[model samples]
Target chain A: MKARVIVSFKDEVLDPQGLTIKNALHSLGYKFIKDVRQGKVFDIEIDGISVEDARKYLQEIADKVLANPVIEKFHWEIIEK
Target chain B: MKARVIVSFKDEVLDPQGLTIKNALHSLGYKFIKDVRQGKVFDIEIDGISVEDARKYLQEIADKVLANPVIEKFHWEIIEK
Candidate 1:
């Protein structure tokens, strides 16, 4: 099974990286660009686990390590590969 | 219009960050995790453009700025609000 985790900064956490990207886009003549929020995507392949267990375990990992709970949030889904 | 860009390392590019996460997951007891590939997701909010143009312009930004074409590839999609 393949599991995907998406992690992003909390809304109140200012994202300098996103701001920099937005500025870069503006300079590149993509004047239509308004705002940008950047996030992380982790694509994982695993074995010896049921789909349910895969989701459960990945969720734990997401919380404990994949994301920083104080300033970031994460979501995960199982992908059929 | 809103657009999203997903940027990822090329197949030949080594992803040290992904490996770090994999190891972290292993240490966290997510022993089931096998292979991991990490990527970037940019969620953008924009105005004054049709969806088609939004996609086109974001694609250009992705190519020239959002991604390092020498070692990364990207895909973008327009999302309805």
Candidate 2:
């Protein structure tokens, strides 16, 4: 099975990297852009596990390692099974 | 419109960060994991433009700023319009 976990900052958090990218794009003349938010994506492959078990483990990994609960949140989905 | 751009290392590239994470996960006892690939996601919002224009600009941004063609590849989709 393969799953994708996306971890991104909370809505209220300040994203300096995203802001920098937005500014850079504006400087490059792509003025239509209004906002940008950046995040991390982890594509994980698992072996010898059922879909149910994979889902459980993926959630645990996202909660324990992939996301910072204080400022970030994560969502994951199984892409292949 | 809002678009999501995902940029990931090419398959042939060695991802040290992913390897480190995999080792860490193994140490933490998640033995089911077989492989992990990490990437970046950008949620971009554009205003006052047609979908066609947005797509064109998004492609340009991904090529010029979001991804390194030498070792990385990117895919983008309109998530909201």
Candidate achieving the largest lDDT: 2
Model 1 CA deviation exceeding 4 Å by range: none
In model 1, the fraction of reference contacts reproduced equals: 0.92
Separate DockQ for every predicted complex:
0.85, 0.92
Give candidate 2 regions above 4 Å deviation. Answer: none
TM-score, each model? Answer: 0.93, 0.98
Write model 1 residue lDDT over B1-81, tens digit each, in one string: 777788999988899999988897788777778889999989888999877676677777889888999999998888764
In the range A1-81, model 2's lDDT, one tens digit per residue, is: 889999999999999999999999999888989999999999998999899988888889999998998999899999998
Q: List, residue by residue over B12-75, the lDDT tens digit for candidate 2.
A: 9999999889989999999889999999999999999999988888898998899999999999
- Model 2 chain B, poorest ten-residue lDDT window? B55-64
Query: What is the two-chain DockQ of model 1?
Result: 0.85
lDDT of 2: 0.94
Q: In candidate 2, how many Å is residue A4 off?
A: 0.3
- Over the full model, what C-alpha lDDT does candidate 1 score relative to the true structure? 0.85
**Candidate 2's DockQ:** 0.92
